[model samples]
Target: MRIVATNPDQTQAVGKKLAALLQPGDLILLAGDLGAGKTTFTKGLALGLGIKRNIKSPTFTLIREYKEGRLPLYHMDVYRLEDGGAEDLGLEEYFNGDGVSVVEWASFIPEELPAEYLEIRLNKDETDDNKRYIDFNAQGKHYEKLVAKLAE
Candidate 1:
């Protein structure tokens, strides 16, 4: 599904909506350029899940875990592992853990990903810095329904 967000708030709203339908072990892959609102969307998801802590990008730390939410949020930024290092992170532990996993720059660790996932790609509008084009691509039936329900 393709969604156009005229502003960051709208983009976050979409993420918040998706969060309501999430289940444990859900995998979310966020793809986009720098400052494309990936983290912003995540903040919304966290909020929807009743998490009150401040959400930040895990660019350097790799993975930031937030367990205060309805379900734990395993937020990861694998961009730094573009060359190698995924094996050292033991990413499988988080993917299989009892939480909702959101991976930024997931392409860097494609080999480490599960067979199924929801990949959301964000593209910044050329004319509007705050505008983004969000595309949701589901790799399994579970995610397909999640996306359908999110649109509602």
Candidate 2:
């Protein structure tokens, strides 16, 4: 699905709707540039997941685990990862484990991703500062189910 978000809140709202469809062991690949409201969308997802703690970007820490929610949320930012560091950081464990993993700057660690996952791409529209074009692709049956759930 493709969505045009006029403001940060709209993007967050989309994230919140998507969050409701997630299940344990699901992987979300977030693709966007800096200041594309990726973190804001993540915060919304955390909120929908029933996470009450402050949600911060895991830029330096690489990953932030929030077990306070119904299902653990492993939020990761791999933007700072160097060659071979994405896998080295033990990201695969989170992807295969009993939690939902959302990876920001996911393009940097494409090789570590599974064949089936939800890829959310955020793009900036030069004509409108508040505008973002988000493209979502469901890669497998798992994601297809998510898309179906989101449509509800």
Specify the highest-TM-score model's number. 1
Write model 1 residue lDDT over 80-125, tens digit each, in one string: 9999999999899988889999999999998999999999999999
Point out where model 1 deviates above 4 Å: none
Of candidate 2, the 10-residue stretch with the lowest lDDT total is 81-90
Clashing pairs in 1: none
**Candidate 2: segments with Cα more than 4 A from true spot:** none
- Write one digit per residue (lDDT tens) for candidate 2, span 1-152: 78899998898898888878788899998888898888888888988888999999999899999998878899999888746577577877898998889999887787888899998899989989899998888999879888877767
In order of appearance, the predictions have TM-scores of: 0.97, 0.93
The lDDT values for all models are: 0.92, 0.87
Candidate 1 accuracy as TM-score = 0.97
Assess the local accuracy of residue 95 in candidate 2 as a C-alpha lDDT between 0 and 100: 89
